[model samples]
Target chain A: MEKSAGSVGKVVVDNISKSYDVGRLKEPVLDRCCLTLPAGQLTVLIGPSGCGKSTLINILAGYEKPDSGSITIDGAPVGGPSSDRLVVFQETALFPWMTTFENIVYGPTVQRERLRDEIEKDAAGLLETVGLREFRNKYPSQLSGGMQRRAELARAMINQPRLMLLDEPFRGLDAMTRELMQEYFLRLYEDKGQTSLFVTSEIDEAIFLADTLLLMSARPGRVIKSMPITLPRPRVPSMLTSTEYLRYKEEALDILHEEALKAFEGGSQAAADFVEAYEERETVG
Target chain B: MSLGATSTNAASNKSIPGQQVGEDWLYRAQRALTTPMPYLGIAGIAMFILFWYLTTEYFKLPRFVKLPGPVEVWTEFTNPDPIYGTSMYTFDYYKHIAWSSLRVMLAFALATGLGVPLGLYMGWKKKFKDYVFPIIEVLRPIPVLAWVPLAILMMPGREAPIIFLAFLAAFFATTLNAMLGVESIDESYFRASQCLGSTPWNVFKRVVVPGALPDIFTGLQIGVGVAWFSLVAAEMVSGEHGLGFLIWDSYVLSQYPVIVIAMVTLGLVGYVYSLLIRIVGRSLMRWTQKGQA
Candidate 1:
């Protein structure tokens, strides 16, 4: 199958606010969050821990209804989970019962937007692209963590969704594996350029992958800053020490530190770790 | 995601080589049969029989002097023309075995057919559970044998009462475990299916059924075992022809070796049933074995 480049329209999340009922208390997570993912761009959502990135992703994916506001793709209001917006979850959700090939074919096959034979052919192609052709018959549990995540990516891409939501897709992998996955994912994103909302807590990752970087506030999160990353395409590992990458990193870390302090004042231990982690990274660099 | 393929998911501590996934089922079965585990299991059974023989046959302790020894039971079991009519060589013994097997089979089938669907719906929908769970809670705790008097009163014949008693025992176990199985699945799978544009029915078919199977089979195993237990009790109370009836009749007639023979047959048949369930469960849940190689 030839690469189908860039068909998704802009995704506008307009003032989405959400909270959960905890006992008698109403705990707000996302506070009137607003952002725009431009067509065919990799938009990275970076925030401190507990800043409700997953909640916003959930809202965007239509898995949960926001308390107020709306999400639109090409002027169509997002009401519920649909094939148009697919999410690659933080924890691997490859349907442990299904083999890698089955999982990749699941979305299109279930949606009935394409024929089974066509989907199977495309799935076979995707398996080769993801380098999982040899492992296609294996179940999720039998594959390595990185392989599962890659299979998840293939599963989402096969749907050809207008928007892709990734919630820290590599959160738990070792640092080395995480970097390699990021590059591998970056290559796929560059080739297809699907409009994406990628969530992460790592500033370096955000700078490495984002065409447009979004920084969210502490708790009750909303977009506090949006900046365009002018780095060249086909990002390389050596960019970690480049002046341009470091510049983006410094700005992101500053905003993140301020948000961490806000959350710390609000008595979040997770924010304390967030602040300390960046500080340690600063000293080491 | 990784080209290396060496690192496995954290959920599985051990990873079987991918090549093993393609091994033929019959080859694997042959290997399993040839393993040392079965021989060790046989040795364990032999030791247990030896202990029984020492106590009841050779030692003749006061507590066991009346109890029939393993040798006496074995002799009657293998005898072509035994004195007692309830030996393995006799048609009467086969009739008892067949009756007990048929009742247990009927009870297990009825309970599983009704219980699994009810349990799945109960766990899937809050309204359904609210309407039904309280009734189950109140009725489940009542012992199976306790239902005998009411069952006999409600049902006309000896067969109906015995089967009803056995059904009640199996039903509670199957229902509760199937419910627990549905509840045990991670929430993310449901969410993932929704995002992938699966219909509500598809979610139930693709997610709910396969996800709950492991627990459903567990319930079936326990349910079948409990059904056998209650079936025997019901037979002893009201049965005219079954292994339980044979044992009771032997006791009354002072046919001590026949009672021992009936008891051993029950154990053997029950063991075979449990093993059959486990084999079926393993085949249905092939994915679960990927990490255990």
Candidate 2:
């Protein structure tokens, strides 16, 4: 659980491209997107609403296959869902019929038999950590939105995956709950040292949770920038009020704003130009 | 953390006052009484019987066509020889009741055992549904009574019509409900199961079966009621010893008391069967009471 630094557990995306047949013609959603996720760190992917941040997460989680290119996790070629890579979707994916305790223990019970007792113990402790031990016997419908999301997080972490994929995990929470959840995540991440890929539209969340931020263009999503956070952890709620956090937040917002305007005005043409520029820059560098 | 602590403290303080305990008890009692209609229905039946007794006995109507009092019925129930049979000294009313109950039980059990699994399969798999659903739809509109001629032609014996009628009554209802249950399952649930290294068989066993249980139980309840109705019709046509047969036989013999008793027994048996099915359903779906869905 000791925290490690740098690009130790590298994720290689080899010219990944994805397209959907939305109309009669196939429309490209993500075009030749290539990026490396650094090891033992939280990397945030930020973009506008329809910029395919979720698609990238789904591809990484093996929920959807890209039309072209390959993604390698650790060193193996990603084929399908595995215990090593776990996804906490934007939606609360907790089984409605299951109690909170059952949801948390599900992954562990499904994956490893020898670790059953240990997993149950760990699941109980996680419920306490998420402040849901009292509600453990309650079903998902009994919990509030925040509590459901917390249970989902605990469920995802129970399996102890090498790479955690969070797709807008705190999107619908109130402002206060969202801040508390971010702090809880930082604490858990510090304790576990799991590499994570987090997708979000919020600039402040990206700055707060990520060790390295990967800014993406609007559509046919390609990484526009990759900036490492100089801010130290454990990142507390007070860090949001810090001047350094504000500076990083401003930088992410500026990039997002320009992309949003271009997306609004030029549409697919702007996206094509952005991808061309991104590819050109990659070639030159 | 501060916000959560404040809310928890507020909730704990509210619990200590015990202000709502008496009111809560009263509310719960009222809710329990009103939630199930059968409790209220018993009171209604008592009132109706009281009115019947007063109108017939106290008002003193003509003896020939006078409303038969509950006392008379009670007397007839205890000593059935004069009222229930052609002979003045002998009547075997219990024999008819036993035979009727046996036929209903046999037919209902046969229908449920056959209908449920077939319904589950039709609902679960698309390929099975595509082939089977059309056939079910085609057969569904035809009433169980309408199948009497077909049953007579197709089946070898008299018992076959009775069983066939019960099966026809239940089959469509169970199948349709099972299909709805399967269709209504959350797609994400299946996806999640598949993603977690679950094979198709494991997914069906763990997720699909449990998810569809509530709907399936609902179908079973409806099926039982339908089966009882169909059993009555079947007995009316060709039964040798059943409540329906007793009613028809008593009518032919002009024994009005026996006919009324047979009708009452038929009603009571159907009501009891329905109540039993509901109890079974409620117990099986006890988790739903905890608000799982």
Error of 2 at A141 (Å): 2.1
The residue-by-residue lDDT of candidate 1 on B31-50, one tens digit each, is 54455358789899899999
Candidate 1 CAPRI assessment class: acceptable
lDDT of 1 at A135: 87
Question: Candidate 1 chain B: worst 10 consecutive residues by lDDT?
Answer: B1-10
Give per-residue CA lDDT, model 1, range A52-82, as digits (tens): 9988988888778999998889888988888
TM-score of 1: 0.91
**How far is B110's C-alpha from truth in model 2 (Å)?**
4.1
Report the Cα lDDT for residue A34, model 1: 93
Q: Which candidate achieves the best DockQ against the true structure?
A: 1
List residue ranges in candidate 1 displaced over 4 A: A1-5, A21-25, A277-285, B1-23, B27-43, B291-293
Clashes (backbone N, CA, C under 3 Å), per candidate, total 1, 0
Instruction: Fill in the DockQ of model 1.
Output: 0.45
Model 2, residue B262: distance off in Å is: 3.6
| DockQ of each two-chain model | 0.45, 0.21
lDDT of 2: 0.74
Error of 2 at B255 (Å): 3.7
